[model samples]
Target: MNNENSKLTISRIIQAPRSTVWKAWSEKEHFEKWWIPEPITCKVVKMDMTPGGGFETLMSENGEEFQPHVEGCFLEIVPLERIVFTTVLTEGWKPNDPWLSMTAIITMEDASSGTKYTAEALHKNPEDSNKHLEMGFEEGWGTTIDQLEKLIMKLA
Candidate 1:
């Protein structure tokens, strides 16, 4: 479900087990592999899966020179079920003005087909939501999810 007021959402039924999908997300090494749209690369700088813990990554096109991607903190973590993170704060609950501010909620659940993965990006206002949509949120997020499923399939 998506909210036109200030949220954009996407969900998919990943044809893999929840544990495996969670492993791909919880492990930084595995996370770095599919966190971004490929051809471009992602480098996981830090991922501490706890309340007030940091989650940061750098991205690059050439694989050498990297640029800042996401520098944020995890607001909540429910083991393999859900994770809430916000870009408005850094690790340890420190305030930071990000280029774009958003809090993301990611949920994974068991499904008959596989794992039901949902991602919701919550913005402070519709203007920000529009900005993200204009920036190709659907395609970008969808691609990464596809990459994730592909990575899991490959590794399996």
Candidate 2:
């Protein structure tokens, strides 16, 4: 992994508590509800909320189904404060190899009446970073986040 040239980070202040935000991510049902953008549906194949556990989510876009994009094991889970995971060679805690891997760090902190959430994705290289950027990283991630905000607010 060429860490020096690859990074994608986004932070948003959600109008909800840290617990709410954490539940939105840690719960399969809640995650599926907001993990995809409009016109795209996501199915959580499996989610084991523990370090070394695994997760996968299938996405269908515009009537076309795509294979799971994320197959990773959790590295850390710190309740409402942070979550760390990696998309490396693994399936339900089993190891294997395919494409590039990434470590995603999600942090949550109290912010007045809500929560300040930050997502930082570290990629393998500048090329991979550029590839993700070209794949609508801003729009896609932004929309998913918007969906999360809406879902949390609705439940709040």
Best by lDDT: 1
Candidate 2 to truth, TM: 0.89
Q: Compared with the true structure, what per-residue lDDT tens digits does model 1 show for residues 30-146?
A: 999999999999998889999999999999999999999999999999888998999999999999899999999999999999999999999989999999999999999999999
Model 1's alpha-carbon lDDT is 0.94
TM-score for all predictions? 0.96, 0.89
lDDT of each: 0.94, 0.82
Residue 1, model 1, lDDT: 28
Q: For residue 39, what is the lDDT in candidate 2?
A: 78
- Output candidate 1 Cα RMSD: 1.9
RMSD of each: 1.9, 2.1
lDDT by residue for model 2 over 15-58, one digit each (tens)?
Answer: 99998999999989899888878778888886887888877778
Model 2 residue 13 lDDT? Answer: 93
Model 2: weakest 10-residue lDDT segment is: 89-98
| Quality of model 2 by C-alpha lDDT | 0.82
